[model samples]
Target: MVEKSKELKEKEQKILSNKTQSIYALALLIGFCIVINIIFSFVNFKIDLTEEKRFTLTPSTVQMLNGLKDNIYVEVLLEGQFPAGFKRLQESTKDLLDQFRSESPYVQYRFFDPLALVTVAEKNNRIKDLAEDGIKPTNLRVMEENESTEKIIYPVAVVKFGSKSIPVNLLENSIAGFSDEEVLNQSINLLEYKIADAINKILRVQKPTIAITKGHGESKPIETQDLINTLSPFYNLKWISLDSMYTVPDDIKLIIMPNPSVKFDEKAKFVLDQFVMKGGDVMFLINRLKIDMDSLRNVRAEYVPIENDVNLEDMFFKYGVRIQPNLILDLECSKIPLVVGKLGTGAQTELFKWYYAPLLSSNSINPIVKNIDRVNAYWTSTVDTIKTKTDIKKTVLLSSSQYSRVQFAPVRINFEILRYDPDPSKFNKPNQPVAVLLEGKFPSLYENRVSPDMLKTLTDIKAEYKSSGDEAKILVVSYGKLINNLYNPTQSDYMPMGYNTFEKQLYGNKDFVINAIEYMFDEKGILAARAKEVKLRLLDTVKIKNERSFWQFINVLLPISLLGLGALFFNILRKRKFAS
Candidate 1:
């Protein structure tokens, strides 16, 4: 009996010892967790497993975030009930903002649905307020009970840093024949660009000034209004004439010479040369072969190519590039509505490849056009980079596809060719450069041609004629219509640049122009963020539909079955322990 008592006492002591050790171990675990939390609070670490690195921020974005000096308040208007596509967009926006917040403590954001109200009157008033604040609403087709209804929702956000605020469009709908899924995917892809641009705008201290050279047969203001609107938010746009001014304005940093139908006078050319000599950027969107499309209005669709007498070839050659006097015909072209036959008091029109309109591809990995799709070009000429005396760095930003041919000047533009299949043998030219960026100290065209007196009259009295210029940037394109928008008379409004009404698609014109300007001024690599691509991984509809029932059954009942079995096993073990 004494031995049994001793054994019971020892068992109790062992149980007490185990309880003490467990308590000590729990305390140590809590202390360890606290230490880890403290360490992590001072570290910035993340892992992105997405194939396209969608969750990984670009180095430019990271730099921008790290350099923030003020707090940014973002109010996203993509809230309330939305379809799966929109929900995905919302989640993406949230994830992006969360990343920003993690990187910098100054970034804050919230989601608010402008239409989330109890009454129609309240919603209408809210919409009016939003519109007044420059937040436009988009129509979304919401699926209801056995029906789909159109609802207006604001897919916009307002970013405020200090006293400045800029609106960001969350929806990137191309005026093209893209499905809802594709449009949503594009919007997701462009989220970073829109947000980063808004931030860049708000953070800018002073807006740069750019001159759109007029009085040289350039496109009218109405034709270029869309481009103006896009750049007005970031730059101070001015309509300047080289005919009147002896010298370029001091504030004007960039000069855009649009498609000029008239020739550039010697005086104007001298002024442009001096401007470049003084380190000014210039974009020459010119064409050598001017094919008049308006002639098609004359019952039978036909036109002829006329060589434009702009007379700037000599100046361009001095700048290390040449806009050839030829038109590019590409098999990979945009479709145009052509009349095949006549209907009752009408014409039966069908889509045909307009060989004159080359869908120029952006094959360059340059930051300006990297990852950007094809830019719509009409009657574009070939831009050839030639050997020049200056050490110019010429980067080709745009080119035609492999199936392209260059038709030299004085060639007839027959619309009848649209009816017949193009002979592949004729289109032997491959990857013809259409647009190029030149950066270097360019040799002046008026190096020896202009006398001291003539140069003095054109430039500042204190300015000496420079035979060679400082390092400058010049973008030469063989086409000019890239920035022009189509005007709808019925609506009395202008469509977006690069928008094709027939295809309901948006081209890369707007993006290309914006990126061009951005790169020209991007000292901090902010514009490089546009090149970030997020891969789209969509579930196969066929597979989903086929396995729908099985997934539904597993999702609904599997967890409950497992829980019931676990509870039954636990109950049996408890009973056995008590019975023992």
Candidate 2:
């Protein structure tokens, strides 16, 4: 009996000892967790294991976000049920906003579903209201059980700071021949710039003034309304005529000379030269060959392209580039409606590839055109960089494809070309540059040519004649209508720039122009964020289809089986240790 009582006491002591050890271990684990949490709270950092580091913000973006003084409220309209692709986008947006918040406490965001829990009528009204507010909707067709259903979703966000609110379209401009996955990837890549730019615009204290040149038969306000709308929020735009003024306004940061049909007088040219001499930037959207498409309204009509003489060739040659008097014909071109045959009283019209409207793209590493989609051009000519007296850095912003040929002025244009396919073998010329950016200290075109009387006249106005300009930049585009937006008579408002009405497609003209202007005025280096690349890692559909069951078993059964085995092993160890 005494021995039995001693054994019982020994067992009780052992149980007590095991319980005490377990309690100590639990306390130590809790303390260690607390320590880790404390360390993480003070040392804010994240590890990005992505090869592209897509989660890491650029230095410029980080600096900008860190400098925010007031709160920035972002409302993301991508919520509720969506496809895997859109869900990825939404998650990416949330991650980016979270990162922004981490950098600054003033950043705040909310995910909202605009159409959630709404009746049909209410949904339509809500969509209309959002559309009026500049938030466009995208239509998604979903297939379930072989039945197709359509859903409307808004891939947009609104950034509000202080009294300003601007709608940001989250979708990047879609490019032709790009898959939906690639487009989504590109959109994700540009999320940082799009959001940050909206914030920057709202925070701007003063907008730089941009002057549009008039009195040279340039594009009217109606023709370029879309471009105006795009830039009005960021810059102060004004119309200035070189014919009336002796010099461009001192406040003007840039001059946009769009498609001037009338030749510039010597005095006007001299004024422009002086403007460039004073460190002003100029965008020359000029056409070397003039071909009027209005004359092609008749089915059997033919037109000849003539050399357009705006008379700036000499000045452009001296500046380091020359717009060749020819039009680019590319195999990769836009399509136009043509009368293929007659179908009973009505003319059978079909879309035919128009080589005259070559789709221009760029492989240049310049930020202005980096990662930009193909720019739509009509009657675009070639640009050749010439050796100048001073050192000038020239970069081609747009060029033709590998199968392209140039047709010199006096070339015939008609419906006959559309009747047959273009011979690719004959189009041997490749990569013809249509737009060139020049940066340098340019010597004035009127350096020694200015008369003494003109110099005195300049002196009287306090505008000194500069023999050599300060460091300046110039964009010489051989296509003049590159900035012209299509005018829709039905709506009476102009369509967006780069919109092809026939094809119902939007090109990259608007983005390219905005990027160019931003790059020229980019002192903060914000435009560099556009060059950020997020590699698309897509799953192999075939492999997923074939190995679906195997992965499922491995993921589900393997974990449960291992867990059960671990429990069984723990029980056996306990029995062996305490059986005695």
Best by TM-score: 2
Per-residue lDDT tens digits of candidate 1, residues 14-56? 8899999999999999999999999988997778887788888
Query: Residue 250 CA error for candidate 2 (Å)?
Result: 1.9
- CA RMSD of each candidate after superposition: 4.3, 3.6
Worst 10 residues of 1 by lDDT: 295-304
Candidate 2: worst-modelled 10 consecutive residues by lDDT: 292-301
Write model 2 residue lDDT over 95-134, tens digit each, in one string: 9999999999999999989999989999989988988877
TM-score per candidate: 0.85, 0.88
Error of 1 at 37 (Å): 2.3
Query: Where does model 1 exceed 4 Å of error?
Result: 1-12, 49-52, 132-134, 175-179, 296-304, 337-351, 370-373, 447-450, 454-460, 488-492, 501-504, 539-580
Looking at model 2, the pairs that clash are none
Question: Which segments of candidate 2 are over 4 A away from where they belong?
Answer: 1-29, 117-124, 142-148, 296-302, 488-491, 542-580
